[model samples]
Target: YCMSPGIVLTNACDSVRLYGKLSLRRCNMDDDDVQWPFEHEVLLSLTHPAGEAEIHLQVDPWRDFGWYRKPSESNNMSVCYSLRSVDLDELTRDGYVFEDQLRIKCKVVP
Candidate 1:
């Protein structure tokens, strides 16, 4: 997983969006012996210092990017989401980010 900061979220002054990526699998789809054959859709719930709620978001990443564990796109896995300012602030507050406020789980899909 990797995170990039300083993403502008809204028209509000000094607001930013946090970008994140999570790798769920690393096997090629053509490999019959691979365990995960079906695509994965991630379900996430983020906890913030301001409040806690399950924000429904599309799992699509920026179109120019491909969601894969390796250089190949023929993998049976994909999912992504956008992060909020309060969540990002809490994550990087002390000049060091240790834990992710987002709790994620996966569900297999065709």
Candidate 2:
């Protein structure tokens, strides 16, 4: 996960920027069994205090990108999103934030 300060919008200045990126980082352990360049749809969600506040986002893998291909000594990140594109303010207002902590979930569809 990566985070940064609020980003300015060109068209809608009042609109909030994304919370940050949620990425799939490769582990150092050998993953020869796994196929290269993921080709599945990813389901990402933010746990909400109120069930109605839960947010779900779907992302398609960038199979053609080198970052999503085979890994090297340095574990690379593949298939990414902006915390599934949920803004910080929205998350907080929706009860997705608790005690300054946020919970995120991910699922890959083959």
**Candidate achieving the largest TM-score:** 2
In model 2, which residue pairs have backbone atoms overlapping below 3 Å?
none
The lDDT of model 1 is 0.38
Q: Flag clash pairs in model 1.
A: none
lDDT tens readout by residue for model 2, 11-78: 23665544333344446444655554256766666767656655766666566677655555444553
Model 1: per-residue Cα lDDT over 47-86, one tens digit each: 3444543333323334445544343432323344444333
Off by over 4 Å in 2: 1-12, 19-24, 28-32, 35-37, 50-53, 77-79, 82-84
Error of 1 at 38 (Å): 7.7
User: TM-score for model 2?
Assistant: 0.65
lDDT of each: 0.38, 0.53
Top lDDT model: 2
